[model samples]
Target: MACVTGKNSKPKSMSKAKEWTVEVENLFRFQQAGYRDELEYIQVKQGALIERWPDTGYVKKLQRRDDTFFYYSRKRECQDFEVHKVKVYAY
Candidate 1:
């Protein structure tokens, strides 16, 4: 969906995720797409729509920096072992 761009859209701090959660999972997807997080994606894209699953509210699709799309399942895609690789951005 379209996001509102504002002064606080940029993340002030970031850290590696220590656990698996819906938010973390989404961040992982953004990371895979070469973005630090959703906020950065929105900023770079000028508020591009982010497709999401209706039922689970998980990321359904993402456009990478190369202009290619990456589709994700409604279920959790970030395994337990990969949680640490996800970066959580603080706005």
Candidate 2:
């Protein structure tokens, strides 16, 4: 048998600045293979890279295009992909 408690747990809150930064990241979005996603940006500040996930405002539009060669290595090059822009979230 188990007993129930009536107390509620409190959730931790972050600073407003952190919340705003997160919102901005959510605004930057991208699409791949018909799937919409976000690409983040990292800024180097005070020896640390400020990282966030992008939202929807980044990509103007995504259009279906024929397959193009991203890169070619003489042997087994299909495992990796190429991205035009990327951010470093961690060191």
True-structure RMSD for candidate 1 = 3.1
- Give a tens-digit lDDT track for model 1, residues 1-73: 2244574566666788898888888888888888887777777787899999999888889888889999999
Name the runs in model 2 displaced over 4 angstroms.
1-29, 33-57, 66-91
Name the top lDDT candidate.
1
- Each prediction's TM-score against the native? 0.84, 0.15
Model 2, residue pairs in steric clash: 25-54, 25-55, 26-54, 26-55, 27-55, 27-57, 28-55
Model 1: lDDT equals 0.82
**RMSD to true structure for each model, in Å:** 3.1, 18.3
**Model 1: residues >4 Å from true position, as ranges?**
1-10
TM-score of 1: 0.84
Location of the lowest summed lDDT over 10 successive residues in candidate 1: 1-10
